[model samples]
Target: MECIKCKKEIPDESVFCMYCGKKQAPAVHGVKKRGNGQGTVYKMPSGTWAAEITLGYYMQDGKRKRKKSRKYGFRTKKEAVEYIATLKQSPKKEKFITMFQLWELFQTKKETLSKSKRTAYNIAWKKIHAEIEYRQIDELTVPELQAITDKYGTSYYTKRDIKNLLSHLYQIAIRDDYTDKNRAQFIQLPELQSQEREVMTKQEIELLWNDYQKEPSAITAQMLTMLYTGIRPGELLTIKVENINLDEQYMIGGIKTTKGKNRKIIIPDKIKPLLSWLMETGKKGLIAYYPSDVEFYDAWKQKRSQLNIRDVITPYCCRHTYITRLTTLKVSPAMLQELAGHEDYDTTLEYTHLSIAERLQEVNRLD
Candidate 1:
């Protein structure tokens, strides 16, 4: 065929005449040839329209190369055209990378997390990558994100971690303008089961105390402190040698939130000797001393496993047992609340549990 403008012979398959840059009529086969810098639009196998454009390329030895970029899953051909138009307007788009690569970049740029927390995030990251590493982070939809989370939502802790990690990733994405909204934000974690905490029995407590007396470590001191003081495990991490007053035989503030629980708690004669021995260790800070103060619970957990007591109670149950013992002794409710470091009087009430034997003993005493 001849180009009408240039009077030059054009290839039968060409949509635009190469010599004159004029649009040619469609060949008998109805196929059109695409030109340079002009993008291609096609229907994907998944029944969605897609568009691609040749963006400027990286410079090599001496050759000009074209880099073709694609945007996927547009519902309509018009949408694909608009997408290409948007790409054309952009001076340069961020190079397309897998979600896992973005995560690696994210790790490098973000501030550090605590050691254990970093370990947990790494675990979560590996699990997430195994599921969706091949997928592009920028193009992820809400349903796609929800599906990923829902698949691993069986474990409560894991679900929380996945949501947190996803939010972090999307926050980075939004900051970099890779995405407009954090699709992970709308993913709700499944409701956790309300498993009741089991408090230590008198026999179990005796066993633990005897073990502590037999083989003492920082872990032993932390557990015994929780049992005696009813301090939250976290609050115990903040205990300093200065917080203990041997002269007054009381402890000062370690409670979080407010300074109200900073009152002098009369040190029981029972645990005072142990506290004195620990104080004699002369640790500058944190009486419940571990090399890593933040990992108190982990050390305590490892110690508990080593001891292998018959009934395994959580560290929080130490607070429960303390409150129960105080109730058994008929201590003042207001005083008990203060001792337990409870913010509410009602919260203190929930900790007190009277056994059948104790109730019967009380009834007999009433007669």
Candidate 2:
């Protein structure tokens, strides 16, 4: 048998063409003639004789054109007659929409997303959009999504972000009827183990602090601020002198390029004198006194190596230390959430790590 659409030879029993997915028309069993010099009607191999209409028209360029088309397929001649009576009611092939169209639809609705979510969406698009942009929406199989995930690798949180963006794309496609089904629904994410929370010991903090005092670089001030306040190192880098009120002992600023809700942190008495000194001698902006977060982190790493502190605590450890101490002090969950600028309590909870000594103290108190 040959497919009518593509004229490709197919196996005798094949219902759909392998190349084009077109349903093959059964062989003609008989022929008939219609009035007004229309095309001949043939009895389909399925025992149905239907009119194969040929319409003639002049093209826009003045060329004559003849188009032959079939109306319906039926198992019986009577069914064919009935189908011909309502020929206009037959369903048409759905338009083929591409992944790029769906992406455009997603982009159109991106304004409704949060700024961070928008950034995440764009980042994901940047990674794999080019590879699949021209593909039909129905062609985006689970394996393709998996391949993208594998290609991007596990580090840098890009896979997670891409998954989220793809999920949203699928959702939008379904809602808009662009696709009857989402192939990406079955796509699996690489099972990423949660990052081990970096924590700083009291001795380690003291050693780092001592090293900072000796070196007194911008990293030293940044590290001290991170330990004193539980703010993220990225947030620490954005803190301005105007954001800090030394008399009130709190640093008020927006978090992480304004991704987080605006929040304030109470300065610890231990770091109050240091903050006051910075405030007095500090430049017009940036209270933490670092040129950049990268600079601060790199300098801190160098100092850690110099001090030979094998644990190698990151600046983030100070944020964890603050949360740990706050947990020990029995701060309320709501307050802690607000202090950490976490919209969700679960995120704030991840920072809470109780030391063995503190755990033992709590156990003794239980008695």
Candidate 3:
């Protein structure tokens, strides 16, 4: 027998060809009962036939090899023909890789990434993995990834992180020959607004410092650190006691930038007394810290309400206050850049917001 499509040679009794895997034509035969009670069958063209050879036996090496053939078991000749025709038309099932397998690949590749990269990858993985953990790799579509970006909204940084994770996963798949192309290659991230630095006024600073004197607690120390060092509230909250150097008057370690880079900052004179008090209190390992940024913001709101202060003041306002004070003291832009650990001088300048009166005075001078 020969395969219809590939014309590969196959045994007359065989249902599928060994070379092309194509199903062969069914045998036109009927079953017969042997004297020994075993069933004997033979392929006969168009009619019934008397035969000594059983359909199951094939002569090989001058020996009769008896095999249990399923094609011979069909009750009717029509059913046997239909079964063979169905087998010929059926498509082969393709293997599907699970999401768990893809995640394992993601983890192995993520180990080679930098600390910052690993953090971003982990964050993105957590977000996507929540939805697709039970889905197959082939089941993941572009629309599902786009939905994730839509859910996160205009925070393009998070969307970029998610896209980056997908890109890495696709790269792993390509390297392993699991996929021919990366689907996430063409995803566009939305433009994010740069955070505007809001500097507090001298009067606002005086009000906060005076209010701190009245309370003189851990919050006061936290506020002082922000004002003196120009460190972000998130960075300050994570500060440990060991990271500070009272003798050198500096925060030596445990301060991470928004971009996830680590750096040291010099503590100014304004926070010197506050740092001294915190150190003298003998808190061994962890710094005496209060709540997080969100918590602090809530407390700040309540404090504002109590003080009857109409101005908007945030914990970050301390950083603004410090930058404004530096500009007022006529500190060089280079020195400000160094103190703020800013890569760009323009970023340091943004922190130096001049008052409306000062702006008017400069304009009047030009007139």
Q: Arrange candidates by TM-score, descending.
A: 1, 3, 2
Top candidate by TM-score: 1
Off by over 4 Å in 1: 1-123, 126-135, 139-154, 259-266, 280-284, 289-295, 310-312, 363-367
Cα lDDT for residue 14, model 3?
81
Estimated TM-score for each candidate = 0.64, 0.51, 0.55
lDDT of 3 by residue, 189-238 (tens): 77777775566655656766787778765665666678888887766666
Candidate 1 lDDT over 291-361, as tens digits, reads 55336667766766767754458788888888899999889988898887777789888888788889999
243 Cα displacement, candidate 3 (Å) = 4.6
Q: Compared with the true structure, what per-residue lDDT tens digits does model 2 show for residues 18-135? A: 9999988755455765665344556766554665544222223444344344665556555555555343332321334456667888877898975556766776787787666666
Each candidate: how many clashes? 0, 0, 0
Model 2, CA-based lDDT: 0.69
In TM-score terms, candidate 2 sits at 0.51
